[model samples]
Target chain A: MSTKTILCIEDDRFIGEMYIRSLKKAGYEIDWVVDGNDGLVAARNKSYDVILLDIMLPERHGTEILEALRGGKEDLIPKSYVIVLTNFQQDDQSRIAMEKYADAYLIKAEITPKKLISIIEKIQD
Target chain B: MEIKKGPQIASQFWPEFIKQKIVLIIVSQIIISIAVGCLIILSGFLAIGSIGFWLILGGFFVINLATELLIVISATRPTKDLLAAIINVSGEKSTLTPPNPNTKEYEKTGFRDALQKIYELSSVKDKQKTDESEKKDDNQELSIIEALNTTICGFITLDKNRQVIYANKPAPIHTNVDGIKIIDLLFNGNDTLDSWLDSCEEHSVHDEHVWTRIPDRLPNEEGRRFFDVIASYQKGSTAETVLTLIDRTKSYIVDEENLDFISFAAHELRGPITVIRGYLDVLGDELADVLVDDQSELFHRLVVSSNRLSGYIDNILNTSRYDRRHLKMNLAEDKISTIYDTISDDMKLRAGAQNRILNVDLPTKLPTVAADRASIGQVFGNLIDNAIKYSRDGGSVNVTAKQNGNFVDVSVTDNGIGMPESVVSQLFQKFYRSHRSRESVAGTGIGLYISKAIVESNGGTISVRSEDGKGSVFTVSLPIYSTVADKLLASNNSNVGLISEGNGWIKNHSMYRS
Candidate 1:
């Protein structure tokens, strides 16, 4: 088996660095982007096995990225599993919309780096 | 005051004396007597022959005496009758009887008319006094209603027939409410307003309801409107049903904007906390081997504090959602054991930090309950958090669950400072903390309120029993899933999310039907 690649789109610098360091230590090739625009560009540029997306960011939203990637009958990145990670509590309508496209939705405050690694490992399996 | 009273009495007495016909009779009698005396004196003074003068004087004297006697008899008879009639009428003895038809003198004298006029005038004055006071009262009531019109609250009074009997200036701003049924004023009228009026009438009590984005018939530039309607029914009053409407549109808009800001702030605050927690976990893991006893303990405390902060954020979010009535619950068959398993580690950690023992005992064959897993877990989390916070350092907190006839009862007991009965009664109210606890403990005071809301929304009941100096036990009972499955399935077949069954806050979402 080969090492899996993960893309983390988070706005906070500390959280982004933590994700990179933890995923790298866990033997995964991970790329981290700090804002929604850059994150969407990178996501479209290359296909990763798993994508961790944050909802609120500068210039764009994670929901918009999800819509661009997986709104149609065929996915833009076919085999990538999208996980929505956010601290913002969503209203019912947006939450239902996001749930339709995202594979897993997790609260950022509730999930640590170790738990994040396990979640990624499970998705890989 | 004494001088004024004397004049007032004199003023009243003169009018009454002049109104009597006896004054006219006395004046006429006086004139008749004076003329008779003059005639007799003149006849005696002009004696041309002694015998003739004497005869003339006697004739004059006899005629004058007879005339005077006749005048006295006629005048006294009518005056006496008039006096009797006046007394009879004034004393409330009987209605005035008209003078004899044969005696035309009575009408000629105008005595009867005078008496009738006097009686009518006095009675009319009495009636006018009463009417004046009543008018004053009416004016006062009118002024109150006029003042109310200047306020934001609109007032409308409805008769028993539902007609708009009275409406203030603000009341008719939305519709031409005059002479129309109150129910006809609103666009979605009959369903909510009609039933609310019926309830008020049936109970004869005051009630209130809210109407959101009402009156589709007339849309304005301000967009949607909200009204907090208060209604009351008064038996035997001019207005049977009184309706007061306070336009809450501005406040409603403010609340919505506030919720948005809260969501934004929560996201900002949580981002840093998440980072802090992540780094702390990383440090704790990386430094596991090198950290000594106190250092490890310090690291654990830091993690617990972060977790507590995270819990506080959740509480605030939940409270806001509850206030907005936007807390949508997805209730299904959930196991109590599963819920406890998810939260036990956190609960134990919190209690252990306080040097307290935490124990959870679930029966082997516990039944599944109809609940939302995440929300119910939060409920347990809040209860255990309270237990750990309120208890002494070395006390123990026990959580147990059992099946109780069509329901599962879960109880959390704490061997800590208990609450008085008075405090326990208000424990679940929003922002209610006992005075002592408020001074000593740090809390938002909405944890139990949110927990209760969540539990009841899931068709369960939550209660607390406490003894002041001893301890406290909080119990939650949720309906067994199998017992309510038939009803749930019926509701599902009907295409409603959940059959309210009395819980009216739940919104219908097709996805949550299962």
Candidate 2:
């Protein structure tokens, strides 16, 4: 089987590093982007099995990036599953991300890195 | 006032009423002329006969005076009827009519026509005067409304039918012209505006101002804008209002930012805590064979303390979420006993950790509740945790459940450091840690508040009963799934489910759908 790849777009450096460490340890190839703009560019460049996107980012919001990717004239990254990982747990943001075709909404502080990786593995299966 | 003035002028002004006087004068002159000529001719014949000539002259003079008086009296009678007709027309008592036809032909037709023309002119002048005053009043009212529109955040006036009669600058800024109903402009999409307004009408009280978040579709960019809506019904007036929205965006944004900061801070704190816990778990598992007895116990203590701190952080975040109305609930139909069973093991473990005995008694036939199972668990979990926290060493903390009428009443009774009546009343308030427990107990003081919010949002009530130096019983009463069905059956027992049929509540089938 081909190697499973994941993209983690998070602004928090430590959390992002922790996720990268845990997922790589779990034998999954992972790419991490710290800002929304770079994440958008990276998401368009290649397809991944899972893309963990954060709502709050440095340059642009994750919702806007998701909208640009999925709500465009052509589907920018149809093969990738977008999971919204955010510290902000507001209803409108959730609704917007879901409406823009996000596959899952998870609070970053609520779930552990191991559990997140296990979820990704389940999606792969 | 205008009608009275018209009649007053017609009565007091004598010259304007001369159409009748002119006719009387002409008829009296003709009668006098004919009488003088006849008398003169008759007296001349008497004088020629030379006997009783003086008596004949005297007789002619008396006959002439009598004819003149008769002519004057007849002319005055027609004039009085003409005056009565004029009074009637001016009083708006009847339509215009000519005087009784006792006078000459010119007096009948010509005098009546001239009089009618004069009356028409006067009536038109009165109408013009009234119109001018009304126009002035209208202009004054317009200026007042314009001033209000400029000074206030927004102003919208609806006519009795609730159609927009006037809307000011900020009105169009929020409520686009596409939204015709005033309710559309005022209500946030979280609730149905029509039903809310109908309730408002039914209550007949518009004294309260409701705070609503403006929908995102409107041109508010900074964040979600809020408006304070005040509605007043103007009975028998031009405007019957649904509501008026006053822009409260600035203060609302400040409040939102504060709440957001709390949520952000709580999440930031929890992130490191989770990582620490994650690493600790990995270490404990990896080194389980190598660690000694004391080290293992120390690690276990660390994990318990970390978990406790994590729970506190969660409480803070949940409190922030509840305050901002961002808490999402996934409601489902489940038996109350099932919820109790799910959390009873966890509650017992937590209580055992704190050196307390936790007892749970669940009735077998408890009805199902339409509630978010996880949220209800949290609510019950918080109450049990509080019971354990407050109880003395080895004290009994009883969690009991029973069916009470339409509700399932679950009570958490603790025999520990009981709070006073005053403290019990303030227990559920945000950030209200009790004075007695603050020194020894570690808590965020928001667990009870969050629990109350969760319970209430699930169509339940949470209340406490306590006495000074005695234990407290915190009871959560949730309305059962069949409660509405039972009420529906009782209110209209013969009709079954059709009572709320079109209103979307199917009696036995989906009354618990919400």
Candidate 3:
């Protein structure tokens, strides 16, 4: 049997609730954090399959959270891969995220709900 | 200065001679007749003469001469009364547009009342009416020509020889020229524009002709803050040159203020869009895959709203440039073909969404016109966008280019809802739109006016023609830059960061997919 935990961090309550309902429906145990500070602490304390990062977050900001996970700060337990969520276009961020070891960034509008499932499942594999 | 005692200029002395000739000729004839009568009487004395006979003959001659002089007096009366009658009649016949006639409404009260109103207007100088009042519901049009003579933007038209063919009242005050050589309005001896004038005259007879333009900062006085004087070919069956003076200083200041706001807003907005994209990537494809539920609908709504919001923001930013009316052209040597291709590609998405077709027929090899690249690009974009917006569903828009020696002509043709002759008449008016806009099209009515202003600023011209039901075509001509910009371009020849590089930080956006 395969078992994995996913940390979904988001600021928009509507999309945050969608993530909790959808990922759990897909049968992965999910840890949901609303703010950037909670997301930072949860990543450090828990072991998770993957980290779902929302670039726009209310607390502690998305980039600072990425830098912290990249070991910008002292320590974190789970060495989970990071997948970015963004609406802005331009290759620079994708290139830089890879330089810092981020797995991928999905352009927000370009992806549909069905497509979003495929990308998440592949990353889980 | 010696006053020459010889015959003066013909015009001046001809009147005096005419006056005196009638008096001199009449008086002399009377004397000569009187003398002849005396001679006849005295000579006849040898036959049947009495002293009374000579007196009666002389008196009869005097009376005849007196009658001739009185007839001449009536003939010599000036035509001033005739001119007064004509002015009074024409003023009564033709409608006095707006503010001029606003007071005339009192005339329906009675003839006595109308005369009283006329007396009132006569007492108040025309200057008392505010500019706002002049703009009353195109309800009426007063002779803007009459307004020009006094309020300041003097209107003047000159012929090929720099002769003052027409001058409105305020010409001397605005131009600071005291009825001197008409060419003096355009050039001074210190400025040698003989060669430049040659370039301008070539356009005079052609479909588009223009003179060398020297836009200098207008001497700043209180009301005369800054003015732009444009001399362009007013195309007609027989083409005439038209010069328009626009006071841009107030509009210029407003533009500067708007530009500042845009830069500030743009800078702040970019940071948030970058952060939003970062979160989207982290959520993975799972976020979009949820659309089967109501949650997905929310996602769709979010995307649509943001896209529309951003589009409006971009329009405001673009128009802000022309607002200040302060356009500093960074002139460069550029190929028209490449420029056309770039604009076509950039606007392809807008066309695709509307299912509109854009056909560009530019020559493989093109002559270069010296111009501001970004400004010209925006001009093309606005024109094409207008075409697409007004076009029938799935209609085609065509662009064609050709060079005639010193200028490049670009025409954009659209098989769209054509403009009626009435609307077409004011095609380039600010905030002017046809009745069709109220029905289907959307616009601010400022696009063409701004486009015309930009093309003219760069020593170019823009024109249009449209049939009521068929379609419309807009043609623009820009002078081909021969040398200066090309030389500068040769030295700074790197294509790296030549265009807008967007704001600084890119690594800040990583982990973005889709």
Candidate 4:
């Protein structure tokens, strides 16, 4: 249908709005979730080209949710793609998140919404 | 010979100890010689009568008495000669035996016995001990002579005329001069030495060794060495000055290292922390709607950590400002009630996440305090931040501000775990944190220190009182108005933090609400 379907899961209002605006302009079909439980439900019900997630959340943390989705425990959603968005730049956190099948790690300060959108699009291609 | 007058003064004048044997020896020798002299006279007397022999014996006896008196005088002559020689050589005087009354126990012992006695008085090995002692005294005298004649540490001694009398070893090395006045030694280049010496000479007495370290830096050198010098005057003697030098390069090096560590640490922490907090702000926008479903304890922890990290980064930033002494502040006239109001409303939402309560005790007729409003706001904001971080779940914080005699006193009382006694004393010390805080809270311990500085700079005083397991009260008093800076110090407390609770605002906030 669309160029690609991207599921965006994040907890911060400012950055989420920025991502939503930029991804929409990037010409991608997107479904958004602010809560971790909602994220699980959204992914389970629909198929997406990629998922952009935040590490710290009010529901389940981005890392924990990513772990469950990629652990192959419930296979609630088709394992299409997953990317982590966080402010922390520690190497250990990156390694652990990647080990759990997070497709990309981008520092929020180093990347803006448009920059992140292009990178995700490139990965999809 | 008789005993000397040293141990017994009165016995020196008494000639009762001449001894009969020495008297007899002198008498016999005199009789043998004088009898021969009288022999010719006796022969003439014998031709006339027996009176010749009697006259000869009498003449011999008289000669022996004269000879004994001369021998006694000659025996004491060496001591009198030495005393006169020393008086002529040194040109100073002491309580010495005058030649008019001198005595000695010449028959008491030999030179070996005398040397053995000297060795007993000395604390040294017996072998050449006399020589060793003499050598040591000679060395001491040589050192003192060198110190007096040279410019060791620029030292010199002068008489009442201010003429050069003595100098030290370092004087020449330091000043490259010899034989200068005491005043010249202190102020060889500066004119102040001239006036200071004039004043001391005119007014001061009993020249009690006045010592001061004179610091001088070499041309083009960044540091200076200190020279310690002292001067003292005996009652009847000329005043003397002694000096010593000390180098402080190592101490300066240590200070530089401390500054380096603080600056390095400050920059290292803030770079990554600013990025982390920025991302957290991004997450708040994205997770607003979805966060309501799984409001687990884990989410609360994540929120608290982010806030704590943000506070830590701010602490680092504050430290950098403090180091430069160029810290920024916004001074304004603000009412105490207003500051409390802003904190209550804004801070409540923050406290709500952790389920804590803030009780405000503000007087309606509050006094207006003149201070840096933003810095003051930050001060209490940090206090409230610490209150929430340190308090257990469901604890309460009480804030009170009252007017008392041209000042407004504010107190923040928390029902949190109290700090250690040692920590309380240094609560306002920069970078000093409690062991409990290290484990329980994520903070830059500089909050209280900064608060104290902020309060004091605005003509106010801040203090803390805490008891372990009981609670803590931080009190701040500020002048009514008309001051510039609010804090006394710009604190760098980067290692301070607070632990997080399971149910926290980081998870349940309007920013994160869908």
Candidate 5:
């Protein structure tokens, strides 16, 4: 079996670096982008097994990127599972909209590295 | 002297007798009859002829009869006319014939003129009284308007046509409200006021509605305004609808600005906490094999404290959201055990760090409850965290879940320092901290409040029973999924769960009182 690959789109430098270091140490190939625009570009260029998206990002919102990727009747990246991880709390309507498109929604402050790894493993299984 | 006194007394008596018209007439008749008798007797004594005596007596009798007729007419005619005039005036009929100027009947009797003057004076007096009463009513209305004007709240009275009948000073502060429609003056194409008025008219009852962030009509003014408006249908008042507007602009703006700042601060704080927690998790995992037991325990405590800090941030954010009525709940059928399983590991870590034993008891088969899983997890997390924080060293914290009829009850009991009845009574209030624990315990005092908010929003109830020097038990009961699923699903799209608007729960805290 090949190694699983993950793409993390987070704006904060410390949060982004923490995700990269932890997921790399957990034996997964991880690509980190600090802004929504580059993250979307990287996602379109090469498909990863899992995509971790953050809501509040520079250049564009994670929601806008999700819309561009999978807002149609069919998923743009059919195999990639999208998990929304963010500290930003969304209103009900926005949350309901995100829930429809994303595989899971997790609060960043509530998730530890081990927990995040276990959640990713579960999704992969 | 006696003769002189007799004449003086006779003069006084004659004038008095003359004043009495009926007596004078009767006396005159008697005198005339006496004169006739005297003449007859004298004629007889003088031995006059029988025919002459008879003739003189007949002539005296004729004069006597004529004088009696004159006396009867003079005595009764004026009285009859005066009585007829009185009846006419009392009956409100102007039927009394006007006195002829040529005949001068008014000048002759003077009674008709006197009655006319009395009638005129009385009618004038009645008119004056009515005018005075009307003036009093006007003054009363003016004073009421003046009183209404002194208040900071705006008041306006509208007729059935929605035209402004009366407006206080604050009501028309921005516009000239005379003859303007209420909708035009205060609202620009907003149907809420119109609908509220219509509802009041339909129900014939007083109804209240709130309008938030209403902009000023004046072009130069800045900032938004809030109003608590009431529309009432008064049965007998001159106006159709009485509108009372309490300007909540200042307090409302202050609350909004404060909430905004809180939200921003909480968001900023969340990022750093997330980073710290993530790095700590990474370090704990990487050093798991090399670290000794005590070192591992110390690391775990760090992780727990960081998690606690994150929880505090969430509480602050939730409290601010609750105050602004912006907290949204998406409820679904979820198992209580499933939610408990997600937070039990962290709960154990927290309890162990505090040197408290943690025990969780869940039935093998438990009913599903109507809940928002993530928020409900936060509630359990908050309760257990509180249990660990408040418990004495080496004490135990127990979490038990059971199936109550039509609901599931989860109780978190702690053998802690406990609290008095006074603190228990105010346990679920916002920003309330017991005096005993205020300095010793580190809390924002909104955990239970937000927990109550979350649980109640999911169609559940949360309560606590505590005794000083003993312990505390906080229980939350949620309805079974099957019972409330249909009702919740029907309104799920629009309903944002429990919302208490205004400063309602500040003093009363009635939401969780029972």
Candidate 6:
């Protein structure tokens, strides 16, 4: 089987580092971006199996990037699974992510990093 | 300040109104007199011979014309005076004496007298109508004033001269100082009422606190009483200033206690939950390869329990938010299908864990709803969770969603031990749980309350239909989002046929099946 690559877009330093380390230990390649704009650029630049996008970000909102990725005219990246992982508990935020064609919505505080990886593995299968 | 107005006349009916009728009468009389003169001349010509007969006819014609002229001349002045008198009676003009009845004018005053009578009758009718309307207005004002005086909120009104116009009973109750100048009440005798009054004219003031030190407010009552004062200058013919005062002592105490408890609980619970989840993640990561089969299962169970505990904490926090009326919705357009898809797996897992069956019947396409996604998810999650909890004995929980008129209605049906009528009525109340459910299931009893608040704040309704020994169906109806054109078309349904069609759709859609 080919190696799987994951892109994590998170604003919080500790959460991003934790997920990256955990996923790397799980034997998958991981690339992490800290801001919304950089996440958008990286997602547009490279193809990955899954993208973990956070809602609250610095330069741009994670949902806006997702909207652009799915509906933008520019053909930047191939079709990939988009997972929204954020601390925001608002219904509108979750709905917006899903409406923009998100594959999964996970609250980071509710589930363990390893559990999240298992869910991602299931989705990949 | 109330302005005094004198009794007003309906000036539309004036001297000109009487003059027009009198002119008609005089013109008709002159026409009749001319016809009489012509008849007299014709009879004389028929009865006598040529030259002498013509002379007598002319004499009779002259006599008739003279009499008519005398009558017209005498009637004109008296009729004008009588019209003026009638108008005065109607309050349109100043009082005037009616023309003397013993004079020549009285002989021609019949038409004037009859007109005066008609004017008097109409004036009385007009007066009745005015009095009735005024009485209604006065009653309304009096009732409103009484209500204000009896309420707990204080009301004080000032005239443009800055003098007190009115003060309700609660004004003194809240402020502890009445009959004092408003400026002094606000400034505490610092003499800045003029500038404050000037400033109020430009803009309204809001939420200003006033602390009055009343040494002898009561026996041994020396502390200052706090009041929330809101003032505004009303601009009109008579400019006035209105001030409202509210006592905030008791409510402030209650708010402080509630806030303290919520903050303490949130901090204490959230900190530990985060730490425990973090440690559990570390353990799962560190022991993933070394754990035995049963050990792995145990770990998974622990994770599930932890997740459940965290959700309870979230619900508790949300309940407090609802208590404070602080659940701000982030509204957006989204499909109800997305919510169904997101929570379907969770619901299935939850129901299966309790030895219950979960059935989901979601439409392939539904109208987009104006909603907050996370809030809607929480609402559905709470309902589905409740179903699983209440129907844990291998019962089936059916979930369905479909388009109903302008809404997307979703229902969670559970064939569990249903609640009695009394218990069901209070199901959505805060911290209320049925006795049977309380004994059988462990719950905080605030989940349904928070769910209801979340749903209602997002412009939806949550209702339930159930019977004793039968299952319960909890339904939530959310309004569908419409495009600009669709909204315009919907609003333009002014035709009776279209309106009835809409009503029929509503009735058909609102009907529920057991």
Report per-candidate TM-score of chain A alone: 0.94, 0.91, 0.82, 0.85, 0.95, 0.89
Summed over model 2, clashes come to 0
- Give TM-scores for every candidate, taking all chains together and pairing residue i with residue i: 0.63, 0.52, 0.39, 0.38, 0.62, 0.48
Instruction: Estimate the overall C-alpha local distance difference test score of candidate 2.
Output: 0.67
Better of 1 and 2 by lDDT: 1
Q: B1-514 in candidate 1: lDDT tens per residue? A: 4454322332244335434544565555556655655665676664445675557655665676567656766756655455545555455443334344235665787665766665676688778989999999999998998798789877888887777777786664444446343432342313366777777678765455554433312322235455666667776678887877777767666644565576558667888898988998788789999998798888778888888887777777876676555676766677899877767777777788878898889886888888777778889989999998898889999999888898899999998899999899789866778998989898868799889988887888899999886889999999999998877666644223332211111223244323
Q: Once superposed on the true structure, which residue ranges of model 1 sit more than 4 Å away at CA?
A: B1-144, B147-263, B486-514
Q: Show model 2 residue runs off by greater than 4 Å.
A: A1-3, A24-27, A91-94, A121-125, B1-264, B325-328, B334-349, B359-367, B438-444, B467-470, B481-514
Point out where model 6 deviates above 4 Å: A1-24, A28-107, A115-125, B1-76, B83-147, B153-264, B275-301, B319-338, B363-372, B420-445, B456-460, B478-514
Segments of candidate 3 deviating more than 4 angstroms: A1-125, B1-320, B323-325, B340-346, B360-363, B478-514
When summed lDDT is taken over every stretch of 10 residues in candidate 5 chain B, the lowest stretch is B500-509
User: How many backbone overlaps does candidate 5 show?
Assistant: 0
Candidate 6, residue A110: the lDDT equals: 58
- List where candidate 5 sits over 4 angstroms from the true fold: A72-75, B1-145, B148-259, B403-405, B493-514
List of clashing residue pairs for candidate 6 = A91-B372, A91-B373, A91-B374, A91-B375, A92-B372, A92-B373
Tens digits of lDDT, candidate 3, B1-514:
9776744433334356557767786778878886776676577653336657756765777787778777766554322222223334334432222222224433453433444454456445444555446677243545554566667664557566555566665453234367553433323112233444466566554433232322232222223333445555543423255555554556554544554576458534644543343244345355666556666545544443343334333344434434433334445566777666645544665666567888888896668887666567667877887888888989999988999767898899999888888888677754568777867777766577667766776667888898877888988887887834555467544321222111111122223332
Q: For candidate 4, what is the interface RMSD?
A: 13.1
- Please report, as a residue range, the 10-residue window in candidate 3 chain B with the lowest summed lDDT: B497-506
Alpha-carbon lDDT of model 5:
0.74
What's the TM for chain B in candidate 3?
Answer: 0.44
lDDT of 4: 0.58
DockQ head-to-head 4 vs 5, winner? 5
Better by TM-score, candidate 3 or 1: 1
- Model 5 over residues B90-120: C-alpha lDDT tens digits? 5543434533323476677566567577567
Error of 1 at B127 (Å): 19
> If ranked by DockQ, best first, what sequence of candidates would result?
5, 1, 6, 2, 3, 4
